[model samples]
Target chain A: MTPRRILLGAAGAVVVVGVLEAVSRSGLVDETSLPPASTVLKEAGKLAVDREFLVDVGATVREWLLGLLLAVLAAVPLGVLLGSVPLLGTASRALVELCRPVPSVALIPLATLLFSSPAQTNMSLIFYACLWPILVNTLYALRDVDPVAKDTLRAFGSSTPAVLWRVSLPSAAPFIATGVRIAASVALVVLISTELLVGGDNGIGIYLTETQQGGGRTDLMLAGACWAGVLGLLANTALIALERVAFRWHAARVEGIA
Target chain B: MLEISGLGHAYGTHRVLEGIDLKVGEGELVTIVGPSGCGKSTLLRCIAGLVPPTEGKVVLKGAPIDGVPDDLAVVFQDYSRSLLPWLTVRDNVALPLRRRGLGKAERRAQAVKALASVGLEDAAGKYPWQLSGGMQQRVSIARALAYKPTLMLMDEPFGSVDAQTREDLEDLVLQVHRAEGMTILLVTHDIDESVYLGDRVVVLARNPGRVRDELPVTLPAGRDQIGTRADAEFVRLRAEVGRLVRGVVKDSEPPDATDAEDADAEAVATAVEEPAKK
Candidate 1:
């Protein structure tokens, strides 16, 4: 955007921080419970270099990336199968509808019982949460591919697989990228939430749980959450940049459609 | 090199095309003109193996064509839909070459040459959407030309462009046909277009589409819009084809109109249209 817009955006953040600091410091809220904004900011800064916190960050990033990658692997092919084969999609519709909306967090009991390890449990939870967006996006994108383009390829004697590979896949790629970007956020949420609730062996979520349980360090809990939010923002920005660079024409087309 | 005999197609219980029998010898440019619902596009689809006929079959070069033949290319009317928007103009042209097992360099080189042929050399790097309607259709033509297909099927390929662009595209096809002698079958509803492009024009009637008449165009080759269209032969042939497509004729009108009117009605029940033999 414009430099003025960027300056205003930064000013907006400052105003928000200024208001919170005022409220927290004026004794409007008890410092023992709220822990002034400055205290939280100081904890967040210190946690940036804290090796334990760094490890926690690394663990969460690893789980988020791994879970997202696994979801892509499972969902893309399934989407293609269901998207390309009408009969297969019709057959799977009932099962997909039944399973898609059930909150993934509710599956923790089943995952813990089935998987005997916490890492597996975290992976399963994130995987379940990330799968729907990627799969559904892929299915719809493939469906949205231009039929005439596919027919043109076929008229040149390209087989069904060739048409899919050459036309349908590339056409659906931008949508797939969007799905991945969305899933990156979803995976992070599920990862951190599962770690918090289940108290995994070592994770940002578990670390946040430790901060609260070990004498209630609310600042550390908030700081850790702040770091998680930063990571999610950074991941999404990178994925969006990747999508722009790789699919410029698609981006233009999407904007036109929008 | 292409033969369609007793070809009929019905989508569900609704028959769209029936008894469509025509043949194009090697190097012949045959155009089909018909009313809007005459299933002209469906006929092209059947010939290209995009759709199969329910009645008779399409035999290309002595083989019963059940699927899209390896040496055929199609230029659809909707260039926005036909040309892959994600690909640059050059890449879209080169895409059909992938199945031919060409290397990257060769495909690019051939694609560039094809783009040059279609007068789109400078547009190679641009996306199809960045260009005007005419240029987008040119990219579609370039894609078809790059394939080096033995037979080309164009379904109202210039229908979306402006009149000037349409005429230019028509001339480009003629120039390409003269240069490569590629057997071509073009379907259009524009009566003048059929008369101008084809060595022979096949006209189809609507309501379970069937061939109405086949008129051999006798205008001399090396045609241009100025000299060729003004020729008396060209006017006669255009009106004859117009009569066929518009379904307006009267044997009592005049000597010129009567000749064309007499050619219709009984255009049915005729299988082998030996215009040369007649």
Candidate 2:
């Protein structure tokens, strides 16, 4: 990003904060329901070092990572298999279309009944939420592989498996990484939602629940939300950095086109 | 040696090629020239074992072809799409060598040597996209050369480049063909290209694509883009092939004359004999 863009973004954030601060302190909203922006920021800063809060953050991150990893491990191969084999892809189309659109949050009630522990319930919901993006991205990426490249390898006497390994997989990898990055953010959202709804043993969502139940602390609730937003931002930034480093050729091609 | 007889192909009910019979002796260069939609590419694909003909068979050295043969390579018309962009030039040239059961170092060494032959050794470490269109086509040719195939098929290989680059690539093909002494069958719609590069030019008719005629190229084996193309024999053969491709009657022959195929074949044969008789 350019320094000018960074400066503009910071200015936008400050303006938003200033508006929130004014609206809260001017009695436009009830003090108990809407904490001042300064109070929320202070509380968020304190929570950054709060040991109990840190534990909840760690638990949420761990669950998000685990669920996203499982989804990628399961989805990439399944996507490749479906993409390479036309008959199998056609056979599974009905089932995939049916499952892909149902929101994972709506499955929280079923997950709770199916799994014995809170962690299990959250993990299953996270996996379900993260599966489709990675799968669909991989499928489209494989379809988009350069047909001539595949034919060239085949004409050189390369086997089907060799063609897929040498050409299809590498061509699809950048898209698959993009899919995983998208799934990572989705996993975090679902993990926190499940934790809040199911009251997981230790998580940011569970901590937010504690603040609501203990004294209805508006500052603490907003601070918890701020952390969730921060975590998402951090994860996305890290994954984008990784993509740049790993797929320099893809990036160069994209830049050339643009 | 390679032999194809009574070969025919159809995509579902739409017929693409019909009754194609051709032979390529060892160490010979044959060029197939035709108009668009003549299924020249399909015929090449059939011989490469990529597409199965609906009728007849392709025999290579006494064996009926079932799948892509190990001792064959193809230089496609589209160099940009044919070469993998992710790999460096050296890697792309070496990729097919894995089938030869060579180790990494040997593959790299051979790839470098092939690049040098194509005069692209300095660009070995660069990606395919980093090079110009002409340079990329050279890399693809180098890749095919490194494979050391017994039979090499080129499908309109220089159809994309500018005229100057096209000449350079044509000479590169001749250089490699002469140096390696491999059987080469090149297909193109350009009548001049066919006469310029081939030891023999096989012309195909468009509708239900079939072989129209085969004219043996009598030009000197040592050819240059400038000297060879300006030769009298080259001019005569090109015009002859051009007329055959456009399915036009010779200026000396009447337009209303029937039996166009027999008349054209007989006239071309007579024209081919007159020079040798002198």
Top-scoring candidate (lDDT): 2
lDDT of 2 by residue, B1-278 (tens): 99999999887776778999999999999999875566778888899998889998999988899999889999987788899988999999999999999999999999999999999999999998889989999999999999999999998888777778989999999999999998999987778889999999999985577999999999999999899989999999988988887783346534332323222222323333323222
**DockQ for each numbered candidate:** 0.59, 0.58
- How displaced is residue A255 in candidate 1, in Å? 3.0
Measured against the true structure, the TM-scores of the candidates, in listed sequence, are 0.91, 0.92
- Which stretches in model 2 have alpha-carbon errors above 4 Å? B248-278
Candidate 1: tens digits of C-alpha lDDT, residues B73-172: 9998878888888888999999899888999999999999999999999999999989999999999989999999999999888877777888899999
Error of 2 at B251 (Å): 19
lDDT of 2 at A24: 93
* Every model's TM-score on chain B: 0.88, 0.89
